[model samples]
Target chain A: MKTTIHLKLYAGLQKYASASDDNHPIETGDSVREVLNRLGVPPDKPLLVFINGNRSKATSLLQGEELVKVFPPMRGG
Target chain B: MNSFIGKMLNVDLTSGKIETVSIPTEWAEKYTGQKGLGTRILMEDLDPKTDPLSPQNKIVMTSSIMAGTIVSCSAKLAIATKSPQTGTITDGSIGGHAGAELKYAGYDAICISGKAEELSYLYLDPDKAEIRSAAELKGVGTFETEIRIKEMAGDPQVKVLANGPAGENQVLFSCISTERYRQLGRGGIGAVMGSKNLKAVAIRGWLDVHVPDMKECLKVAKELHAADKIDDAEYEIYTDGTPILVDFSQESGLLPTDNFQEGTFEGFEKINSASMKEVRAAKKACFSCAIACGNYLKGSKSDVEGPEYETIALCGSSIRNDSRDRIIEINSICDDVGLDTISAGAVIAYMMEMTEKGLHDFGIRFGETEKAVEMVRKIAFKEGVGAEGAMGTKKLADKYGGAEFAMHVKGMEIPGYDPRGSWAMGLAYVSAPRGGCHMSAYPIEAEAWGDLDPYTYEGKADLVVGLQNSQFAKFSMGVCDFWPVASDNLAKLYSVTYGGKWTAEEVDIIGERIFNLQRIFNIMAGFDGGDDKLPGRFHQENLKSGPPKDISMPEEAFMKSMQEYYRLRGWDDKGKPTLEKLKALGVEDRFVQQYETYLATS
Candidate 1:
């Protein structure tokens, strides 16, 4: 069965895709790494991934209906 | 003498004496400059147990060896004093032209002691230093005080550091405002100034700072700027300033909502970077800074330099008030009245919780935006309940019986980061020489924002120690925290400015030494392992939302981490630095022997 996730990109990472793509199709067992690969994130670029507002490893499997967020490595304050 | 002016100004208000003293070469070599040098000066000038508000207390203002140079972000001014709020050795870094101007004025530092006979301001130019009456400018807001001082000096370029009504009232959390925007923002430095009847200081100078190699300095500065242009973190800072943290904090369950009852704010979208960008008026920067991180905003009813991330977190999410415009207005009032926004928000939020719980009736409720603004004003003017509120969260909680939820580590209020989500941040806050300061060591960068697991206590102690050491050294060197220079680069900068062959290892040692020096001063002031603790609420209560939902800082784990942190720093279980560690850091023999005897007897 197919599933979809809400994807958000921030801090100059939106150039790769729209800032918020409310419904992005994914497989039931697709990993964050797979999603990033499909989204055209450069393989060597470092990113902070979050699934449902929790810090997630890129290789962690994602469930459908998750709010997946990606950000460029950023720090201030 | 390459970058330092090699002259120090000693101002004794009681005697009306102003003397130019040569800075000791030994002190310069040992402490470097800025916070480190200022800390050393304070150590020698005032007894640690002296009342912070009394005339015996001294305020040491020092510039780094790099100030007044073409170095990027090298214009920070360090102000060190015993904090009236925390009674700890506290030093704040003020950014603007003040430090650079002082260097240009042929002085590396100013040590101000003794109470003035009356209200006064200091005026310093190339060859003149005078204590002038500020009785006419009494009770003026910091913004107007700056304007009036400039008029008095007849130079628009004159940099002014002034305190407002909050300061004049001796508010425990009052801040010293500079350039009418930046601040010596924490630990009640302004209160000390007010206690001394010092309302403001105006400085102007045009002399060229001597550099060992002007050519090399320019090349290094250009390279640093070029690198900053392409860096993603710097770009985010340059573009979004600090409100970008709102997005990350909200996402990571670390936005500090409702007095840290919860870590995430549902109304975060109303005050996040996107919301702030809507009202963006302009961007500003400190002198010689490449990263222009200051966001000047024009809200619907108010205009201000920022409601920076800390202000937004404390005044917006933490208070449950999400109106961006009101936050900006609150920021303006705090800046104008010379109040520390972090502590002000902490006070208001604590009172809100107190009132809600029926512990005490502060007449303020959660998300009462208008009431919150009024409280800020009242706190500044010492009106109504704000008179008590100006005493800060710790004392309020003490009297009102809410010590469990006071949100202060020492007597000083906690900063924006809620520690339950990032355990190491708790360690950093508790172990900070000053109280609950985020700038002491930002472990959240590694945890909430980076790759480290935010939930675990493992390895946090080492991370906190490393960051603290590096940050302390950088502050001493007068480098801006935002620059993120590596040890090698920092060593190179030092070598160029101080005319020496400095190594990265040596630079790291300087950081360690500065950290130890502050710790020693605090220990001497009577702070110990007992004082290195978090508010009970963090341990007893769980955040109710986001990823950190149902999570509390485990008391056992936290204590373990604290002990580990002390061990890593070569401090005893009681959190006093060991004699061997002090000696290794090249601390003077007197301090080493004093600690040696204390440790032996204890």
Candidate 2:
């Protein structure tokens, strides 16, 4: 079974986002890092991942999460 | 002078005496250039608390040693003075040919002192430098000034850094617009120019900068430029310029609306990136910039170089002017008249909100662009309501009854970032040496797009402090922040350019010293715990509606970060640098004496 969650990828990861039109469908108990891997983001590139507008570690569970946002390294003022 | 030029053109406007002075190599080793070196000059020379408009107040225009190098984004000019707005050590960067041109003219800096007996403009070349009367050029718009001056001087290639009617009128928030489109657009640097009775600064370079190691410089430049092209897949900046941030700000719950009453604008799509591209005439680049994030949009209102994110958010969203065309028109008018768009939008929004609240009615309403548009002209000429508007939001709030929502820090109006949505950003706003500045420490990306928790209480200080130090270091080295120049590479490039051994660790240390000195300049000017604070709105109010709702600046979480930032900065509890910290950073004893004296006097 799969649970759906809102997902947004920005900066460098913006182009890799192909999870339907918007919210991503992921395994119910997928870890944050697992979701990133499933999305095909480069493993070595620095990223800031969020679960439901909150900073989430790679080990965090997504079972209860409803939103995810991933971002790539960006520098500007 | 070596490759650094190590010489400055010191022009005393009153005495009409221009002299060449040699800068000590020791100064370069310590402060780097621009941000650090410029601030060190101010701290050592002027009373940090000197009234900004006074003749006694000095302003320095310094370029980085790499400014004229083949390196991309190396053409930025740093201008520093006691600000009429922030009343602290205030500086901003102007991009385009000015810095590069000035550097090529055999001087690293053009430091202007003493007010002129008559309005004047400076012209410099490799052989001759003169202060010429600008009487006929008074009240001219910045763009026309550049064009007309070039015609008058018969040199189209000469770069002109001029203020608009606003600067000539001495509007407190007026900014210096250079390269026609780019600006040193914060803390009323233009007002300082006006106070000096100087109208415009024009320059042409006939000499080439001596690159000590061209091969190494080219290798690094090629790699950096290549990396920049692919740095971000979105490539929004390269494609759409900063207008790309409009939709991102709206979507991410960070768009400032109704003078920051809300975090989202309803008219986001109308002013987003795609719309800007439609009107974009051509892409623009700074002097030697490869990424060329600047834009040139052809609008029915007037062809403009911007309506960048700040203009869209401040004038369009916050002030309720939803039409992209209208925003572009206002942007053109502001540029033409020489107003800082951020402060102008902020001031107009404050007036609109005040009139709505019946606290004060300036015959303005939100979403009504006509009065505001008309006021843009008046503000530059100091005409009528524009006179009040020229004072910017802080003073307007002080007179009217809306200090609560004035949206400033340390008397400088804050930018487009909604602090409640990003805690670290809020900390950056309050603790910015120049007040409410986002650039020195842009950890907002961490919360907005990256790893830091936007709403969390912990590690914010660490993030802001780290970014601040790194950024100051970057400014010192005169590297453009937008370029894909890594710290390691920056140190390497600097080492090669200056023939000095600079390790990445040294970069961090030098950056810290520069950062600490800027803070010490503020502290010397009598800024205490009181100046390091957010506007009344952020502290007491939450966004009424947005994706990031119920978010007010959590005082405890944010304050903890501020304290941590102070600690990391090696400052005492009162936000003053400790003696030990000063010693470590090599802040001179004379600076300490001045700091203590001003601290006592103020």
* Among all candidates shown, the one with the greatest TM-score: 1
The DockQ assigned to candidate 1 is 0.49
Clashing pairs in 1: none
Best by lDDT: 1
Most DockQ-accurate candidate: 1
**DockQ for all candidate structures vs. native:** 0.49, 0.26
Put down candidate 1 lDDT per residue, B1-602, tens digits, no spaces: 35866788999998989999888888878888998899988887577779999998998999989998878888888899999999999999888889998988878999999999989999988779999999998899999999999998888999899989888899999998997779785889889999999999888888878788889877876776675553344256776878988988888788888898988888998998889988898889898887778899998888998878999999999999989999999999999999999999999999999999999999999999999999999998889998989999998877888998899989989888888888999999998899989987988888887778889999999999998888888889999887878777888888788777888888888889988988888887777899999999999999888778899999998999989999999999989898889998899998777656655655
The C-alpha stretches of model 1 lying farther than 4 A from their native spots are A1-5, A15-18, A23-43, A59-65, B224-234, B594-602
Please tell me what DockQ candidate 2 reaches: 0.26
Least well predicted 10-residue stretch by lDDT in candidate 1 chain B: B227-236
Docking class of 2: acceptable
- In order, what lDDT does every prediction score? 0.87, 0.79
